[model samples]
Target: MPIEWIDCKPISLVWFSWREPLLYVLFTPWLLSLFAGLLITALTVVLSIRLSWLNRSLIVISAVLSVNIIYSPLATQWLSVWLSSQLPQTFERAEDAPRPVAVLLGRGAKIGRATSRKAAQLLNDHKVEAVYVSGDRLSTAQRVVKLGAPAERVAGDSCARTTWQNATRTNAWLQRNHPEAPVLLITDPWQLPRAAHAFAGQGLKVMPMAISPQLNSRTRNRLALRETAGTLLYRLQGRM
Candidate 1:
């Protein structure tokens, strides 16, 4: 269901959203915290010797407690909202002066296809000269052509999985091909803040055409905790 259609209550929806990947992404920190907590409990027992078995027994208890404890500030609040808030956004086609190059960042083919359709709406009103689709649509090139953009106008970047790279790559392509054209930056709103930063930093005069939304304080606050935990973990592992 569209997020705008219903105000989401976490309690009613979390169980229903309990697919493995979502669980893994949201509950990843709980697992790590639990593991660390158990190791600490084990170390304490090792030092005493008298309570070695007791410490081992306490591991499961500590792990469960750790999972539930970390669950409150992080998982339900920030991570869920961070991920789910990036659903598809519908934008009113830019109608004033022409945005000759519409830069659509791709999370997938249908995503690009949907965004491309929006670009076509802009094109119909002569608002943009062409669509710049950034990401791997794979076989969906045919779909892009089907949406009314000429094949040469659809620029694809298969390597970008992050917004920073997307902005950099799209900017490079624009400089080479359509340097003077004003751009329509199309993407989900939750990620837009960082994206706009990166794109504008690249000196693209961006007119944003948002696809989804950034959740409210109720949601962003909840989701932020999860992302904070995740960011910490990523730092520790040198993955960030």
Candidate 2:
């Protein structure tokens, strides 16, 4: 049920591997941008050969596109910082109050590891009472347990294949188990906003916790462009 092919036996296990989706999400935008630039440049060259005046117009368009592509890294960094700023870094923890639960959005091993570590630390610090992991639930739960989280305090749901599903399933679980509890949502920096919106839409009080620290310029741009495309696609599908 973890996004694997049902009939194919040989490569079905590949679904458990996290690299495929990560690579797709991280590089798809850059690949599309490169393809578009090449196509546009070829078109511009063909147009300029016949109409000299059109050359200026095409050049301007290309220039603008190039600038946007080049500026993606900074834009992504700014967006990440801005999104992170929207959530509180510190929350009041009182002895008599119910402890907040940490919700880890599953994507890959690295993200799961980071979230697990954070969850463990928060547990140690008495910041959260329990940890709920979404995506490939069995594996994620195992990883969190391996990272030192108590098995009894960790819960997981494998049915969530997307951010929306993650939110909805987790919301349902919370409603049944810990209604009105504050949730500390954890995910990649680029996905913070969409994930937060999805969780909030379910009437859950979500406090986003982005795991990644500062990314390099090039990586930031690439991630930013990819996130932008992803956001637009989700919007078109009415997912976000």
Candidate 3:
């Protein structure tokens, strides 16, 4: 029987969805840590006015611990993509990923976020003919990938409404460039189903390259709610 999926739906939708870094950049986990540090710094100032040196010393120690624990790891994660490669096996599809033209979809069209390292290895080995990043040509890196097409075929793109937008824009690009190429759409597991729907709807043959890590935290949880609401708002704005 198909599982009812009622309980799993919201959690899967939130935890697995790729949050494109478009709005409220501060709400990002790293920036929120900065906000936490500032909060503690303010607290330290308030306490220093009342406490003696010995007691104030305790405040300093506590402040550093709070910020380090709450924020340092996030900063490390936001910065060190290398460290992430050391963590336990997260997503498994890429382990034996087929050499379909990697329809690498994400907010960052890099060789890392969606396992560009692995993708690059595959491309170098003639596994994937090209690394097609689907999104607006937001940076020079994206454009550079395209200038060397066939050998690279970067194909930096844009005009996406959501994960769904990534599908539509990529299809148009594919039709213009490699229409016969099969797609190995890469995205967070949570988003793959939704994105797959849009791609299949567009009459494209696709295989999922689910490569995102599971996000578990209060902030990520809240972001899920925010995304759901934001999605509704976009629908209202006639943007979706």
Candidate 4:
């Protein structure tokens, strides 16, 4: 089952299906901010016109907010790049160290194609001995297999719905299976810090390998904003 909070259905369904533009409006940060800014600006204009005593300050505030909303995508991109630079792209395990497992966190019910490709590449490059995906195990395993990975080399944990669950459950699996192996935690750059924290908290040694998406400005901004919010939420819950 999907984690209630991480799953988009509750919010996306209210507007439209996951594939619809309305879902973007509801979940995408830049678009949602733009929509809100426009609405506020329109309201300010109507009030200013209707009341002679309406303060010019309100108009100025609306304009500034609108500009910020429009520019959010660029801001998010900058943040992601900065965060990516602060983390390592590759993990080097000592020759004597046990072979590490590549743990790829799923985006939702599906392990996205980009992540699947990255996992396959890691296996091919000999960066990891095996790949363990968290989220929808069956689907994630299927995706890896479709990407040409041997079925035996890929493992899955379907019960993990949140980052904490991902870490704890995977850690348990590792302990039972490959106790001394370090983990190559995989996810987007923006999500790496929290994921690393969660895994480390579970007493697992982690080496983060981020998959930075090549998204357009608007999409990047949306992802950044979503990641920002997720980070904050995790912090509040004392998970990161």
Candidate 5:
């Protein structure tokens, strides 16, 4: 069952542009750790001329371990599972239920296409009333349109640059037109948790729909690390 109520604490939107950059710098655990390890390794190499061999070895070992943990598949798998654990293990909506409005969270070309494809499928199946592409609006909307969705049936926001913006901006429109309609929040599986939480925070009834992309281990781990950081950041900001 979809979580119907979650109180998202109000946050100041002042200086909102800084949120995304700061999130990666301050809240991204693996990224910050990577930078720290690289810096330590560089400094150790430079100071090895003066430091004792034992101390130098210890620094190098610590740096390597810190960097290696993020690349480890087991570590990534654990984090991925824990992150998505909050999402429903199973979901079912009655066929007679009101049709949901599809909301595709903006992303890169590959994910945009995948998400758009899903939205088109829902539209084609008459499962959704309409499709709204948040964030990268033009690109995503174009993809959905190209996939055969009627131009009039699809709409979007080109201004949303972050997940928070995606929810708030989309809600700005939804609250007036589809206030009572259930939202089908669409995005990559790894990002669905945060995306769902963000949309729900806006007081929209959200049903998560994740589209899995074909990704290599390296790419998948990279995305997982980023999402783990993003989830932490949103929690800190009281957005999730």
Candidate 6:
């Protein structure tokens, strides 16, 4: 039987997908901030022509402050630290529950490879009974298999495109097959907070395991900011 999903719909339309250019930029951190700042500046500049000096001054100040806050390295750093703090140190095992299955949430080829490696390691160590790749499923699953995870022990679906979808889809699968199995929710450190919350919201037992790729400071800050924005958006949508 096919499971019904709540708070998510399977992708049947291409234009509205999150991967579309507009939505992608809107969700991405640095790009969104830069675009917003430019838009605000342009609008205020045009509006200033009709306004009094004081009003123009106010708009300029507001624009500057908003841009500074969003672009601030300190803000991104602080948000990254706070997000990392929300992750669980270890999985809470239950005597009667089946051994945890690693549910690797894919980001991209780089991070997905890193996460697949971690999942393969867990399977080899017997820390997890099986591995399931969500998000970018096929490529990640192939990587996991190549990493030495037995082909029979790895499974996944390509239906998930977002963290919310990853959780809900995997939860539906778990409910139908391994109802009591704990999930080792694997992803990058910055994304772990929102990803874990999303999985837990769908009533899965989630234990976050971060396997971040090697990124420079600039790239890391961008990802951290993106995750921060994602967390807030999810909260507003009540998905977490």
Worst 10 residues of 3 by lDDT: 1-10
Over 102-143, each residue of candidate 5 has an lDDT whose tens digit, in order, gives: 998767888888889989988988789888887674767877
Q: Report the C-alpha lDDT of model 3 over 140-160, residue by residue, as the tens digit.
A: 323334333343455545444
State the C-alpha lDDT per candidate.
0.57, 0.68, 0.52, 0.68, 0.76, 0.76
Model 2 regions lying over 4 Å from their true place = 1-50, 53-72, 82-96, 213-222, 233-240
Which pairs, if any, clash in model 5? Answer: none
**Candidate 4 wrong stretches, greater than 4 Å:** 1-53, 56-60, 63-71, 85-92, 108-111
Instruction: Evaluate model 4: give its TM-score.
Output: 0.69
Off by over 4 Å in 1: 1-33, 36-100, 213-240
Residue 46 displacement in candidate 5 (angstroms):
19
User: Superposing every Cα of model 4 onto the true structure, what RMSD results?
Assistant: 6.9
Q: Mark the 10 consecutive residues where model 4 has the least summed lDDT.
A: 3-12
Choose 2 or 5, whichever is better by TM-score. 5
What's the distance in Å from true for residue 172, model 1? Answer: 1.3
> Which ranges in model 6 have alpha carbons more than 4 Å from their true place?
1-10, 13-62, 65-69, 85-91
Error at 132, model 2, angstroms:
0.6
Model 6, clash count? 0
lDDT of 6 at 201: 82
Ordering by TM-score? 6, 5, 4, 2, 1, 3
Query: Candidate 2, overall lDDT?
Result: 0.68
